[model samples]
Target: MLSTPISLPTVFVGAAIIFLFALALYPSSLLRWFQRKRYQYEVTFSLYMLTPTEKFIFNSILFLFLAMVSIAVALYLPRHVRIIAHRAYYYVSGDLVKNGTTSAVLGTTAEILTPTTVAEAIGSA
Candidate 1:
């Protein structure tokens, strides 16, 4: 059977047989898959269904985990970077207040920015 040449029709028939057998074994699953949902909701398990004590414990553990992660991040990351990020996040000045742009400018800005002292432009490279 394994060595036999398999065609589409033979494979399909075998699948149909298996599916029909499965339909008998698990009618609800088959129905859910084949049937259009009358109302848009599914019967499923959820943690929200947990008891009051379980929910409290779960939330406590979750918050504790989140706090630990927050503290770790705060501790692991340097202070200056955090300050810069915070400032960047809050800064609403909007793009340097002037769109300083130049078309077809290749390192001309670098030349302008570099100060020429004693007839020798400070080595850019």
Candidate 2:
């Protein structure tokens, strides 16, 4: 059986379909997100009426949020990328596993999906 390489747009559409299916299964989650966004938009984030202390407090909270995000990206982003690349490499370029023998794509997906692999990935970063 010849396997055609999936195009980028096709992959994106498939992903979107899967995402929509998930949302369909748990629609309240999506609705809650929309509701949260609506509520969030109701609040005006301005430093205009703030006293010096309030401004400092607001800036501190903003800085902390940004710092945490930066730290998470610095720490986890590389590991996440490495895991995906590692899995893709194994998937695209090795001996193929026989079917009914696996729930994973090549039996390798399950092999690489271990917590050990994830931990190893995290440790390398």
Candidate 3:
């Protein structure tokens, strides 16, 4: 059976229909968001009283939150990447053996002796 790809206009029409249906069902929700009043919070420091604008506080919070998240990712991502890469290396080794290609050299060595046994043997010597 031949499959036909949906066109761009078809997707737009479907989206429009869904949007109109949602608008019909809950028109107030959209209006509530658009017509909502901005909330302001005052921060009092010892030197100065600052009443930051809603947008400024929101932007600052967003920026600081994202910055912290980025820093955390930078600190932790390498460990995860190294673990995944190590697993992938072993998986590729097994695949190479199955495919009758040159088996990974490290994989052959690992098969001869488990890592802990090899470490203990080496340490005893």
Candidate 2 lDDT by residue in tens digits, 29-88 = 769899777556435665656787987898799889999999999999987887666567
Residue 62 in candidate 1, Cα distance off native in Å: 0.3
User: Which is better, 1 or 3, measured by lDDT?
Assistant: 3
- Candidate 3 lDDT over 4-23, as tens digits, reads 98899999999999998988
Question: Which candidate, 1 or 2, has the higher lDDT?
Answer: 2
Higher-ranked by TM-score: 1 or 2:
2
Model 3 misplaced stretches (Cα beyond 4 Å): 1-52, 94-111, 114-125
Number of the candidate with higher lDDT, 2 or 3: 2
Model 2 error, position 8 (Å): 66
lDDT of 1 by residue, 1-125 (tens): 57978899998999999998987887786487655352232223244467868767876897899999899888877765765654565365332212133211222433233234312433433
Number of colliding residue pairs in model 3: 0
**lDDT winner among the candidates?**
2
Candidates sorted by lDDT, descending order? 2, 3, 1
In model 2, the clashing pairs are none
Candidates sorted by TM-score, descending order? Answer: 2, 3, 1
Model 2 TM? 0.39
